[model samples]
Structures are given as structure tokens and as C-alpha cells.
Target chain A: MKTTRRTTILLALVLLALPLAAFAASPSDAGTRWLHVRVVDRSDDGESVRVNLPLDLIASILPEIDIEPHIKDGRVTLAPEQGVQLGDLRAVWAQLRQAADGEYVRVEAGDGNVVVRKAGTLLEIDVQDGPEGAEKVRVRAPLAVLDALFSAPEGEIDLAAAITALAEAGIEDLVQVEDGESSVRIWIDDRPEAP
Target chain B: MPRPRVTLAAVLVATLLLTAGGVVVLAAAEVWRAGTFVLSVRDEGPNGARVAVVVPGIVATLAAVAIPFMLPDEAAARIRPAAPAMRALASELAGLPDAVYVAVEAPGERVLIASRGGVLVIEVDDGPDHVRLAIPLHAARRVLRSVAFAAQRTR
Candidate 1:
């Protein structure tokens, strides 16, 4: 009788835990994945524009792309359909390649791809798999106001110049720029207020 | 006290198996994809509980694909053309702004929040049978309820 009772109790406990275990095992087990993609650029004449590029980029660049919203491992993951061409990503990478220095900035370009990372620079650019194996590059800002420094042909991409242009456009909003080993961050004056 | 009699071990094992089965089923069926949410709903018949995963597509294709799996051979014969109905419904829901806190419904027939309009038409395939909701956005949800309802709803 005691053994039967114990077995019953065990079974009940297992039943109660079934859903909880599944929930815990789910990627959300850690937390929900919230992705925010911010794109800031100047239009030829230099009117500072910053907009959320997550959905828009998906629609415009990869029409057939799929976006899975989930939390995987410990970090939030936005697994976009194979390849999505993010304009800001391309622009940042182009700038990084031009600013590559022998020691600080390292450039590895092969297999129709390019990667640039500068030790002291305010940004770290990651170029990886995208839709249909296309290059999906991500430029991370390590500092609150980190800027990418690059030297492009005559009128191409210039990091310092872009910074100057941003400042001139109304960066009393920009506070500080932090450079990381992997990414760069830019802090704006209205940051604490503006996200 | 009136207490329930159930075993914890049995419960856990059963739950694990059920969850694993669900995961496997979903993966195998390729029901997992972008812009789609999986949901479990009960049937409204004497048959009691039933699981039906809903998807968006043209009505005819939906009827064709769902009839064989959701209903028996006899009932599928009664199903008729649903493409015209789905197209009308899809066209109405296509271009609404992404504003939260709105309720769109048709009295007792249906009450739902406006989710984004995708390429395919919304469908409800009750196992072995499919039924297309002919009501469009304008007719389903009254303007006042659609625009003023402050409750949150996910499409």
C-alpha cells in the first residue's frame, strides 16, 4: 500500500511539472527576446534621421524573409530569414574597410565578404550569414556616442567627417562615444530621454 | 479536506511525453515559420476536445488542403467555394495602421483585435473540415468598438 501511495504521489508530481518543465525548457525559459534595430544616417545634404529599422529593413530588403521572435540561450535572438540586406549595416562595413589600419583595424575579406574591427575605434562590425547565405553584417556601438572612423575615396565614407556632420546636424543630443573590442556605442544628449 | 489523488512521477512523465510529442509534431509538420503563431483551441462539438492549427492562405487551397486532414470523406463533399469570401475579407484588412487597443467584431459571430494583414487569407480549419469566415473587417467589427476598445489583443 505504501509503495502504491508513493507511486501515485510521484505521478501527480510529474504531471504537475510537465508543463512547467516545458516552459522552463523553452528559450523563453531565460527571458523573452526583444530586438531593437536603430538606423541613423544623413541624406546627401545632412539631415540627421534616426528610425527603427527592424521591420522596415525586413520588408524592403528581404521581402521573403521570415522573423522568429524568441529568446535563445541567455540572449535575445531575432533569427531573420536567411538574408536581409540592412542598409545601415552595409554603410557601416564600407566605412570600416576604408578606415582599416595595419594594427588597430584588421580586415579579412574573402568568399564575397568583408570584416573590419578596430581596437580603439568606437564600433565593431560583424559580417556573417544572412538571407540565402548573403552577408548579414551588424555594427554594434560600444559607447553611448561611439562613431565609426573610416577614410573612403574622395567623397565616399569618412568616419571623422560623419561625426562632424552628425554634430553639426544637432548632436547636442550626442553625449559620449565608447569604443569596445567588439562594438562601439554612441550616447546622445537626449539619450536618457530618447532611447 | 477534499484532496485530489494523483502521482507526481506519473504526471511529470506524462507531461514530458506530451510536450515532446507536441514539439516533434510541430517540427515535422513544418508549422513553424515566420509571421505565424501556433495556438491550441477546443472544438465546439460533442466530440469534445480537438487541436487545430490555423494558417493563412487562399480559401480554395485551404479547403483542399484542410478537408482531407480535418474531416471525413463525406463532410468534405458539402464544402463549397471559399476563395471569393477570403479575397473580400483579405482586401478589407490589408491597410490598417498599427495601432493597439482596438476591438473588431461582428456581434456574436466573432470578436477579434486587428492584427496585420498578411498575403494569405485568415482561415479556421476544424480537423478534417475547413470553414471560411466570410465577414470582412468593416462588417465584423463596428467602428466604435474597433477604434475605442482599449483592451489588448494579438492577431
Candidate 2:
């Protein structure tokens, strides 16, 4: 009887710790990702702005916003005259998702250079000299976010799904723009606060 | 012997009354502590004035909780569809970690919105005029959830 009692106590302890162990394992799965944006303008009074927002909260609230005539129900319907076909985007994304990680494109014009590539789980874009003073521009996004972006129906882009994916997928430095006197950075990560 | 017994009985009665009084005071204090919310307003406009208001959060809480019974059926039905999402949003926001969500500083004014210490704070400062509003995050979540519950409880 004592042995049986000990076994029962052990079982109870394990059951009590199960949820806590799960919670500690995957934080992003719990909707704990934060999106951070920081901008510094040295040209002025050395002013800076920082914003950190919770993604799950955004995902929960996105459905209520109505951007009439274009966006509804967390999806965007591209204008016909814009000539952007959903099928084409889907096909291209499928190819990219399957392709091996490598430098895919490099364009050099008279004034600038543009490079697009897939690296590990991220799609990276590096553009230089695109804007007059923007000597370097970099953007990175997870493949999962892109996949979710195109998960909508035949004629729409699923923004809410993409955001939800972004919140779940491992996120890191996303965009950076640097110039002589100003800098802007936007990224998403599991951190609770802006850095 | 009868007089001695009477004295003992009187002592027991006094002890019981004191204990009862102590218990009542503690209960009232707990209630007050649970409902206290502080409001401070300072405006240095043309003339300077400072005022402080102490309000019991229970008033707002009670009003929110009473919505289900007080609201008309048509209105309740109209809000029921959206209640779940609002409740979910409120719940998620309450779980979010403390962070500064907005910080903007311009020439004449500054605005800051942040969640800190289990409270959501919004502050705006423009020269001599300043305003700051803070609400406990958990209290807000409770109120909002109650509102959603009310909406969903339509007949």
C-alpha cells in the first residue's frame, strides 16, 4: 500500500508540472512574440522613437479593422488594373520555398545594386544606392510568413494568417535603413521589450 | 457562586464583541483596498490647478457586470457576435509582457504609451500642460471580459 501511494504521489507531481514544462518549452507557441521598431534622427535634436507591440494582441484585433474597398476580413483584394495576379505570386513563392539557399538574383545599375537571396529560413534582400542617401538597405523575413501571406483564396492575400505565422515563427532583424544622419530599424522577436 | 458565574459570562460576551468588531473592520478594509483607484489631474493652462480624485473601481466593475441585465435584448444580440473576439483580445493583451508600445517626441509635445508593473500607462506632455492616465492591466482585463460576457449573455 505504501508503494502504491508513493507511485500515486509521483504521478500527481508529474501531472502538475506538465503544463509548466510545456509553457517553458515553446514561448512563441504561447503568442509571446513582440515586434519592435526604432528610429533615430540625429539631424534634429538627437530624437529617437521606439515601439514594441505584442503580436498575439494584434492578431486578435486585426479582424475588426475595415479598410473599405480594398481590405476586409483580414485579406486584401488586389485591384484589377494593378495587373498583379495571385496565381503568379503563388507559383513564384512555391518555387522559392523549395529552392536551396543561395544568392538568387543580383542587379547592378548605374547608381545602385540590388541582391535577393534565400538564407536558411529567411528571405533576404539587400539594396544599395536605391535612395539618394540610403547607402544600405536590408530586409529579412521568415519563409513561414511568406507562405502564410499567400495562404488566402484565389484572389486575396491573407494578412492575418501571415501575422499569426510571424508571431509563431522565429523572428529576427527584419529591416534596416541607414543614411548619413538618420537610421530606422524594424524587427520582430521573442523579446518582451524593445532594444 | 452565581455572581462569579455572571462575571465570567460578561467577560465572555465582551471578548466575543471585540472579535466580531475586529472581523468587520478587516472585511471593510479588504473591500476598500480591492476597489481603490487613484486619479490625479494637473493642468497648468492659463492658471495652475491641481486636483486628485479617489474612486472605487467597484463602481465601474458593478456597472460593467450589470450590463447584461440592463441592456435591451436587441442591443445584446447585436454585440454578441463581436464579444468573443473582444474578450479574446483583452485576454491576450493582458498576457503581453511589459513594454513601451509608443514613444514619440516632437517639438512641442511628447507622448508615451507603455505597459509596466501590471498597469497600462499613457502620458502626454505639452509644455506646461501634462496628462497621464494609468489603469491596472488586470482590472482592465476583468472589466472588458465582463463586458464581453454581458454581450454574450443575451437571452
DockQ of each: 0.08, 0.21
DockQ category of candidate 2: incorrect
Instruction: State residue B54's C-alpha deviation in candidate 2, in Å.
Output: 3.0
Q: After superposition, how far is residue A118 of candidate 2 from its true place, in Å?
A: 2.0
lDDT of each: 0.35, 0.74
Query: What is the per-residue lDDT of model 2 for residues A42-72, given as tens digits with 9 covering 90 to 100?
Result: 8756677888887877787776545666776
For residues B1-155, write the lDDT of model 1, one tens digit per residue: 21324344446667778778877865544322223333445556666665655443232333433333445433323322222223333333333232221222222232223233322223344343333332223222232132212111111
Report how closely model 1 matches the true complex, as a DockQ value: 0.08
User: Which residue ranges in model 2 land beyond 4 Å of their true spot?
Assistant: A1-31, A45-47, A63-73, A81-88, A130-134, B1-36, B69-84, B149-155
lDDT of 2 at A171: 67
Please give the range of 10 consecutive residues that has the lowest summed lDDT in model 2 chain A.
A22-31
